[model samples]
Target: MSNDQPLKGQIIIFTGTPKSEDVFELVEQLGGTPISLPLIQVSEWIEPTDEQRLMTCPTYDWLIFTSQSAVESFGLKMKRFGVSPDAITSQIAAIGTRTAAALTKIGLTVQFIPTVFSADVFVQEFKPTENETRRLLFLRGSIAGVTIREELPFDVDEWTVYSTEKAVHNIESLKNLVQTEKSSTLLFASPSAVNVFSEEIAPFTGWDTYKIGAIGHVTEQALIEKGAHVDVIPSTYTLKDLVLELIK
Candidate 1:
């Protein structure tokens, strides 16, 4: 590795949504050529007539937020509904530490979070007691899976507060880059991103020289299911951690 630019001659493509400019900057600092090929984008989903009911009612025993996007969308909708964050007196559950932090910043106390940051682990460990009623409300993205719903043995109401759409981008530049570069690395952050890439982008050739990386188990599974070979996955499920692992 070159001391000044360990990744100086490398090329990397980021295919996830909600990308951070800082991650690209970091890649440049490490001497890698970073490509912005975001395969999916998220938008808040709003339904006025049905959402209006939330402003006047606090009927849920628990509120679940699985992603930071979910937290942001829920916050915006709550404001539009005239429902304050504090007005919902239900216990809060977050899927990951980042989700918990996002909720905490908005003055909502998080009551539960799994150690593994996966839906399977969360439901297995945080089930309601047999006598207790679990009238949980899940605010999530349209593409987010229903693993919690499938695994949880209780009543849970889910509402899609955001939609994940395929992001449109010109692949010509990426194709040119692939042809010229010796090899490249692609990073995936979620299953939805993997699906978008497989469905919309993978048909193109020239990816044989590209290495693939996923953030964690769920994303890795998507990669496998899509027949994409994963070359790396961080022990921890975080972008920062993934970067560090890649640099290693």
Candidate 2:
């Protein structure tokens, strides 16, 4: 019933970028060895001319960051532009807590955040006030399928801040892992991982014996659509809850 209880001798595989270091540390602290295997790689949008313009812009209305990757990508570019990050004086809005933390790490504070961190809610927060229709700059990803522009309450400037690329697993590496079968228990935290993992394990079948743990409803739906017979799903939407369910 408690996550603090020992969970040794049980192996689990983490599927996502290194953004989940906090959760991984918790797993290790709780006697579980966390294996890192990123299903998708978050890449920064590389554009010489476009980035130059974004960096040289004067103070804008709002600077919205949708993902942690966008924050990182924009931060790197800002550093290159000789801006101490303090130069960008737009009221920042982070879509989620993680992205908010990422912004803080680079000396930025989020002015607004919603209860639901979806793109729909994110767009709705961009309505122009009575003062003036402030210009908005949205930092997103290259393959960002989720768009906040369509439902935007106010017309604002926007562009790709970073990009999401499906990571193609190394054949020999995957084969070796499958041959030894080290990752018997796979964890699907997001739907994006489910899509990428399906591709990762496509050529290496015989994974029906492995147990799958879906994190939330969205990931559960992705698992079901991918033909995975999910064996575990925690009621709460957190990694600690999922680890507790496994040990229980």
Best by TM-score: 1
Model 2 poorest ten-residue lDDT run: 170-179
lDDT of 1: 0.76
Q: Could you report the Cα RMSD, in angstroms, for every candidate shown?
A: 2.4, 3.5
TM-score of each: 0.87, 0.79
Model 1 quality (TM-score): 0.87
Off by more than 4 A, model 1: 128-133, 170-176
Residue 110 in candidate 1 has what lDDT?
92
User: How would you encode candidate 2's per-residue C-alpha lDDT over 114-212 as one tens digit per residue?
Assistant: 655656666666555745446677777776554665567666666776777766663345435545765457777778878876766645764476777
Model 2 has an lDDT value of 0.70
Error of 1 at 48 (Å): 2.3
- For model 1, residues 96-143, the per-residue Cα lDDT tens digits are 777888888777889888777778778888866665444778887887
